[model samples]
Target: MAVRYIPYYPDTLEGQARLDNFVRTSRMLFYKDNNQVKTRIQRGMPLYEVTESETVGANPDGNIVMHGECLSTCAYLKDKGIEIDLVYIDPPFASGADYAKKIYVRRNPLVQKAINEAEQQLDNSDMQEFEEKMYGDIWDKEHYLNWMYENLMAIKSVMSDTASIYVHLDYHIGHYVKILMDEIFGEENFRNEIVWCYYGPGSPGMRNFNRKHDTIFWYSKSEDYQFNDKDIRIPHDAKTLDNFKKGLDGSGFISENYDLDQNGKIPEDWWEMAIAGRFPKDGVKRVDYATEKPWALLERIINASSNEGMLVADFFGGSGVAAAVAHKLGRKFVHNDVNINSIQTARDRLVSAGAEFTMMEVRDGVRLFRNPVQTMEKLVRLIPGLNTETNLDKRFWAGSIYDSQKGKMPVYLPNLMDSSSRVMDKTEMNHIIREALPDLGNDVKQIVVYYIDVEDIEELRQFIHDENTQTDIAIELRDLKQVLDDVVIEDKATWEMSQVQVELFTKWQIKMLTFHSDYVMKKIEAFNLIGDQQHQKKLANNKKSTFKPIKISDEGLECIEWLSVDCTNAQKDAPWHSDAEVKIDKTGTVTVNGTKTRNLWDATIQSDDKPLRLKVRNICGDEVLFVL
Candidate 1:
């Protein structure tokens, strides 16, 4: 049957125009590729190597944890021709809340060194900005819709034709997102609007009824999709069993000829599932993640939609309930999220659950050199009679140098490193020169080059000299470092590390361990103060503020959020086989002096392994894993 369209406010001419623009932008998904900074890194980045201990080895079906923007990660999967059978994303509900987790300082030497360096660089006021927020849920209605639309479009591209996707949302924007999902996945593919109702403490409100339920919109990629109804049946109580018997006609079962299966009854659209907080302290699967869903919820979704060995994915990956549950159910999974805290939490959870997954992040091989053109501006100021004009084409030209005696000379800043961060070779240099030739007109006689590092300076000069001779244009290669040294350019070159090391330490027993990482310190230094203040204020005002800012101490352990250790069997060939583990969930309390301090995690190990595998996650979700 065709979908019936009702005339709504958005159907009006003016509203239609706005909606059309949004749809167009969503289809194009320009935001994913428009991040120029990230694009540059993607063009030149390298994947971090999976260590021997982390590798699942020769298995094509092992799970994956990707730390990146979901859109980019989904696009990456699509480009790789990997299709997922099931995708369940619990994206931000646009609830206008800031989620955060408290982190502690690890008492490791490497971490201490980073802390010392940070203390020297930043003052007490700067340390106040170290609070880690997982992700912001606040968004302008239009912006949120457009962002979700683009991500959905990208996600749909990587889904198998027989795939199913469950989008978890709440009262705020569920209805609007349904329309967007219908447009992208087709109205015919719409399956169910599953209402996940839970009982929790409620407060009286004058405006409306208490909202104690969240909506999960299910959609299939095609008409033919997987639905294992038997796997997701709910148990029938004695009252229901008796009622069925009463309804039975002459036959021994319900109705005239029906037979009741031993398996439980199939669940209806309205489901009664408890939230994670309602679980007891010793519950089978309860992790104190702010937005964590119950494992049972994920289990039902995964079992009903996908079979064993089928690929499952969750891009939002909060606390990794879906991935954790999916692994336990014997399904291959891929989880992606931008928050380092989520990544760390999910990695630890999955590892402790005996799931083998490789961790990966999109990283550029060459660090982004800060203000390369600013150096050129400095050079023009230092040299006599040298004036420079900014160029329209930033890719090749930094600016053009103008001299009263000499004709306009174009300046080019060639990339010192190739896509892989290796020093540019002769052929690469020749290509750059060839591409720049057309832009340099007959009036232009000289081209100034500024480079940080070159493989062979003499060879490059010779190559440029030969090109100059052939084209009757002088090509001058100038070292950028030398120019900075000679002329005072108060600029520091900043570069991001392609790979960061994860430090692990074992205390006395196999059960106890400590972990430290410099990655957390780096994130703290890079955190934007303006954004942090806004986030802190938002968190403070909200009733859901579970995080308390830790007072800065000399130890500088404020960046460590949570840590998990999985004591895997050392004698066994499978590194992911866990014997026992400990999970440390830290929170801060105010001291008498009004100082917020976190309790240390002195874990008691239950396994026999001497060097336990530890996963240390910082507040931002970045993690470092090593043998302690």
Candidate 2:
């Protein structure tokens, strides 16, 4: 749904008529063809991406967003198939204007202490810069609504059948945003307008009553929601617990004046907890970001409404206190925020408690959260060739999968079809075969071939034999089949190596390498090489490591190479002879080899007679000379 807010419509007819007098500004987001992911990568930045899984179950997966605007934590959870059981959003309080306090060294000393602590916790330098940028800056209430609306709409999609949504807001735009939520989530789902009351020093605005409490609007996606009241019950009042003393003769004096039950008394809706500075000594303070809710408060909400493994989403994951509470309680969390500083602060807090998170941005510039390991696993399942064999959890490099018992099966393998007589068959193909074969027992004698191609079964069969020639290998050829009836075994003379098999396998091998040559190198080099440029140097300095070469698959290579060559090698002929530019799989063996071609550099160079012209227009209405 499109972003909805009161600002979208004029509040009065006078306001409507004067709408044209307002500033007409447009924020256009253009989706780039490139995927540089410029926002979050930097030196000392916490490696939030789950590159490895913990062998021991010490750390759990959590999602944290920093910097970019967030539209929907629920939608993000839905994308990952993590059904959210509850959503706790403490959006910006629209008290006429959004208020964000400063947390910088230049600010007050208390604020500086908080900033210093936050900075120490952050490992990423680029992220640190982002925090600095947001330091003291506050947003307009209208902007906050626009930001909240865009993200909350996406979040609604990720709620489970029995999910509940709780929104915490102060007197500001609490009623306004509530009306929006009622319309968006349906008025029937509205559960309660929980009044969180606290007695505090009254504000100086004596003309009106002092506002000492905030409102929490509780709503559910469906009538059936997860509300475990027992989890949030409070200890019985001293007087109530002592009632048993009068009722029962042998009741302990500890319960002298109140009635005591084995189970705790359910806390009332208007229950009061220690507010802010008055919290228990053991309770932590939210010194960095002002207006942060207490952990105990969030704990009550989470424990009372969510299951152990159920996802808990927080779109306005402010200082991340809610996320931290969720982690401590053993529930997965998908936390989002537009402010980069908030995400960084949240991440530092979560990581200290031993949780990992991955970050992504949506189309509308909102940052999102996901479990990194889960994300990687899903990608592998969807794209077959993206196997993480070497670094079981690392990104995929172009390679084939071989089963000693079931032969070799290449899924989305490269297309490097070449015909070369001197191609190394046994050594190259043997290497791949050895690598692909999962370690069965050493004494296993039977052998079989499982080729996974509907179109080129014969080529795969020949390729297998071309590498294992004269080995006394007894092989059963299983044609690639998605179903039993789809199998087709060509009538080859023998199961062992043949000249036709060798020739065909060689060509198929070449085709495979050619297809994924660029991508393979990009992956390997990303882990090994560094880009040379001013911005890259800054990135390296901030990241403490070279940025991995972003993936440039065969599909994306045409565009990347065009940009690279057009800018750097404009004078030199476009060269294609670099072996580094391509991969070759031939005759059961693989090699990185190719030839470069010298071609015209530019349109003018390609057309010898082409001319360039430059014209200048004078500011004083005089035309300058044109050069050709």
Candidate with the greatest TM-score versus the true structure: 1
lDDT per residue for candidate 2 within 1-628, as digits (tens), equals 1121111111111212121233336733222211111111111011112222111123345454433333333333444566678899886564543334332111122322454667744222221100111222233444444444434545565677899988898876676567557655777788888888777777676787777788888888778988887787777677666665456556454444654556777776774655763433433346356657777678888998897877787876777877777877878877676554465457545644556565444332111112112222233343433344532211112323456554443332211111010122233334335543333233323343332222244554587666544343444543322222232121111011112234335211111111123222433453334344544778757855444333333322111111000111222222111112121111111111122222211101111122122111111111112112
Residue 574 of model 1 has an lDDT of: 39
Off by over 4 Å in 1: 1-60, 104-131, 203-206, 248-259, 277-284, 364-628
Q: Please, what is the TM-score per model? A: 0.55, 0.42
- True lDDT of residue 601, candidate 1: 35
Off by over 4 Å in 2: 1-67, 72-75, 101-150, 243-261, 277-285, 360-628
What's model 1's TM-score? 0.55
Q: C-alpha displacement of 30 in model 1, angstroms? A: 18
- Candidate 2, residue 344: how far the Cα is off, in Å: 1.3
